[model samples]
Target: MGALDGKIAIVTGTSRGVGVGVSRQLLLAGATVVGCSRRPLPGLPAAEGLGGVEGRAEQWVCDQGDHRAIDAFVQRVVDTYGRVDILVNNAGGTVPTPHAEDVPELVQQIQSSPASDDDFERTVAFHAYAVQMNLISPLWFAIRVYRQMRTQDGTGSIVNISSGAGHPAGSPSLVSYGAAKSGLNHLTRSLAEEWGPKARVNCLALGPTMTENFRAFVLGEQDPEGRAYFANVPLGRAGDPDEVGRTCVFLCSGEADYINGTTIEIDGGMLPGVLYDAGLKTITDLL
Candidate 1:
């Protein structure tokens, strides 16, 4: 029997990236996963019938950024399944907004001139959206899932997907995204303490993972600098999505019943400031 046999799970942002990997692993562990994305569900390219893994997953459309949509989605799950045992709040990313697209130029414009009220309003709006998506939405999911879990099993597990960009050092380009994720890290701890003995909550702060979008934007020959940067990482490479998924399974399974309110770093040993260009040069020069 699979480790998660008979369990029901809800995975958000399963159209691609970490969401796909998490869903694949849960299904392999024998959990029934209901995966959601803003877009319609795409075909499963990785975990379909591989080794005859018998776990099941279904795709649905839900704009997790919207609270009303989240309420509807959670209600739908509880109505159909009667209970929710696991929640992987994975629906988030550094989405580009108007204020974000030309950040350098915009910043220069604001600083070089008398910044208008409209400029400040637009900037705040952008940051607000980021916080809503990365921080508030996950809490919304957890609250709904926890409520349902309390009514039945009372042993539900929540895994919030985070990013290394959320580190206190933060990301310059991903300022809003990082801030929102940092908030999510704290949220995990707070919720775990609040719901303990009934359910568990945890977070995973991820580093570079080879996802479709990453491959397109960061890994190709066109981005040699991006490719070279991996050498600075301790592992000298990006993480696999399945790697993140496996960790999620371990956290959700009976094996991790005692692990609560923790945020595990799954970045292949890479950390900010400790390793960068200087470190890479020393290693490369020796070789």
Candidate 2:
């Protein structure tokens, strides 16, 4: 049997990226996954049967940034599933990345200049909202899951996906974003401390990972800056979606019951020296 046999899970932002990868991995481990994204549900890719993995998912259209939408979506899961076994609150943000031509200088500009109101507003919205989607929303489901799990099975896990932007990899123009994720990283500590040995909480601070957004900027580089940006990565490459997915599964499994309130950095060691080389800001820049 699978580590998660007979479990029900909620995964947000299922239309693509890590959400897609995580959901697939959970399903393989024997879960009935309820996934959501702003995109139309029917358009989602269908289920596939992989060896040693048997699972499936149902899709929902929910813009996680909208408080009401988050409510309704979680309600749907509780209504249908009767109880929630796992939650991966990963809607991220509402803002979409612009086309390369429209914002080709974003990286450089964010680095060179001090932050402006516009920068705080935009990046804060994305990262702060990431906290809401990644923390608050899951808290909602976690409460109900905790009640049900304790009464029934006595276990559950909440995993939040974060970014190294909040770590020593400190971003330049991303003051708001980094601060927001830093808040999330802290929440993992708080939640684990308060809700330990019953409902586990953890965060993954990822770095230089490949996703649809990363690809849009890197794949068709056609520029020296873009090439140099990735060259600094210690791994010499972007992380696969499946790698993040596997980590999610491991955190959710019973094996991780003792591991709570921790922030695991999963970026192939792309912090400090590596991030500095990428032109991202650090303490030295602040001085």
How many angstroms is residue 169 displaced in model 1 relative to the true structure, after the best TM-score fit?
Answer: 1.7
Q: How much does candidate 1 score in TM-score? A: 0.84
Deviation of model 2 at 282, angstroms: 18
lDDT, each prediction? 0.76, 0.65
The TM-score obtained by model 2 is 0.77
Models, CA RMSD each: 6.4, 6.4
For this target, which candidate reaches the highest TM-score against the unseen true structure? 1
lDDT of 1 at 189: 95
Candidate 1 residue-wise lDDT, 42-133, digit = tens:
54434566666443667878887677888898888888877789999998876322234433324434223223457565466656667778
Please give, for residues 79-148, the per-residue lDDT of candidate 2 as tens digits. 8877777887665632222321222224424322223346544443444444465456555545544555
